[model samples]
Target: MTRPWEILTAATVAGSGLLAGVFFAFSAFVMSGLRRLPEQDGSAAMRSLNVTAQRPPLMIALFGVSVLCVVVIVRAIAGWPRPGAVWLLAGAIVTLVGAVGVTAAINVPLNNRLDAGTVLWSQFLAAWEPANHARTILCLLGCALLSVGTIRWH
Candidate 1:
């Protein structure tokens, strides 16, 4: 048997990398898209960029958190006796549950409830500022901790 914790640690590192690539990478993509939106005509590019801004980050956070949970669960299953993992796992849980889960449960539904089309994006940004910021900070911190764990080993 490969043993569960080892599998989990490997998976978490890989999953974190993938999440970083997809979500954190979009910060630049979104910035570029925002920068170009004014110069470029209103077109598919705007829509694509807006969708990316609205989504991939959240999706990535959710995926990363879910994987973190999996890592812990695998540890439990494999009977890995390391106690230090609890810190990294707990940090991941707080960030994921508090940041990603709450945003999806609350803010997203609010966005969906609004009448379709003709939304003031500025207004949306303003309304979501606090929540969005919270999610961003928490997830980034969690990712950092996971990175440390990846390097440190138990």
Candidate 2:
């Protein structure tokens, strides 16, 4: 029978992977597609996306994974010296600080500025795309770490 920690580990891996894919889409094509549009159209479309992104599905995925990361950190600390503990802890921290932290600190503010018309599309794209790329890398890294940890778990 599977334990609670096993379930949590699996969920965290899945959540990080899901977030990685989402960010990858943005980094790979969404931002590029927006950039290809006329400035006003791109800005307006991005503003609409910013508003739409605040809805439940993404909010849950993002914030929920953050919460899960916290729990995983605690578990990793408690289970220190265990085979997978270090990897798990590293994964949780990287995802929390690298992915979610960057989103909260950099991306969201840029999105807000664009939505509020305080920033132009070109300016927003210049900053937001780079940050999105960073978060994408972090999410993929976290997912990889978590997968390794899960595999090492006995």
Candidate 3:
């Protein structure tokens, strides 16, 4: 009796929540721990992390959720005026723009600069942490919206 859209919406909610938690971890303690280290050590550790993050698990989670957001957006638009369409659309947009977009536009570039040894660790932290916080908030917001939308859908 579960419809495809229902499944998709549920998955999106879960995915958003997962990403939020990941971002929150970084904002909450990972970055803090890094900051405690000497500048060169911190920078080196972060660079290593950046390389590891490009691997499949995190990449799939981030990009796979992104792909789902796109689908959810299309579904929300096409199914407009339905019970939870607006909430679903809002959730997808928030996640796509706030989380994924911010990561692509801001965080990755900062990481690249850090990796290349082009930017100081302090400078990277100054910029990256705030952006990470923003994405964390956005992902949480998206998850909340999607959860409400899913409940309303039923």
Candidate 4:
């Protein structure tokens, strides 16, 4: 039977690959597509991209990576470990959790409001940008830490 750590490592690697390849890439791809849309096609794609970009599909994926990163870090440190290992784990946790909060609390709320049609799309996005940026920063940092974990992991 596979060990629990092996299961977690598999999940983490899977999440890492998905977030890196699919979730984040989907948003980027959509935005790139939006940019390439004919000017007359107007704001539908842009609006959709903004809302789609704010969701936390990547958080679940990154959570798996965080688990694996911790496991690998523990393995690497079996003999001797640097202080940064703890910092890396802690930071990833904070960043990932914060990304979730930023999405659920701020971004999702705004997306709901936008979807409700109470606010104009441009106005909604104007409000959405800051929350979106915060979540993006948190996720990006999580990705960076996870990347470090991937490279440093043995």
TM-score of 1: 0.57
Q: For residues 7-122, could you state the per-residue lDDT of candidate 3 as single tens digits?
A: 88888999999999999999999999999999999998999989898899888989989999999899878878778888888999899876789999999999989878889988
Report the backbone clash tally of model 2: 0
Show how many residue pairs clash in every candidate, following the order shown.
0, 0, 0, 0
Clashing pairs in 3: none
Computed on alpha carbons, the lDDT of every model, listed in order, comes to: 0.52, 0.88, 0.89, 0.53
Question: What's each prediction's TM-score?
Answer: 0.57, 0.96, 0.96, 0.53
Best by lDDT: 3
lDDT of 2 by residue, 23-126 (tens): 99998999899889999998988888888888999999999998999998998888787788899899988888766799999999998888778987788998
Ranking by lDDT: 3, 2, 4, 1
lDDT of 3 at 128: 99
Relative to the true structure, candidate 1 has a C-alpha RMSD (angstroms) of: 5.0
Clashes of 3: 0
Question: Cα deviation in Å at residue 152, candidate 3?
Answer: 1.4
Once fitted onto the true fold, the runs of candidate 1 whose alpha carbons sit more than 4 angstroms away are 1-3, 26-32, 35-61, 64-81, 110-115, 128-133, 149-153
Task: After superposing candidate 3 on the true structure, give the runs of residues whose Cα lies further than 4 Å from its correct spot.
Answer: none
Predicted structure 2: lDDT: 0.88
RMSD of each: 5.0, 1.2, 1.1, 5.9
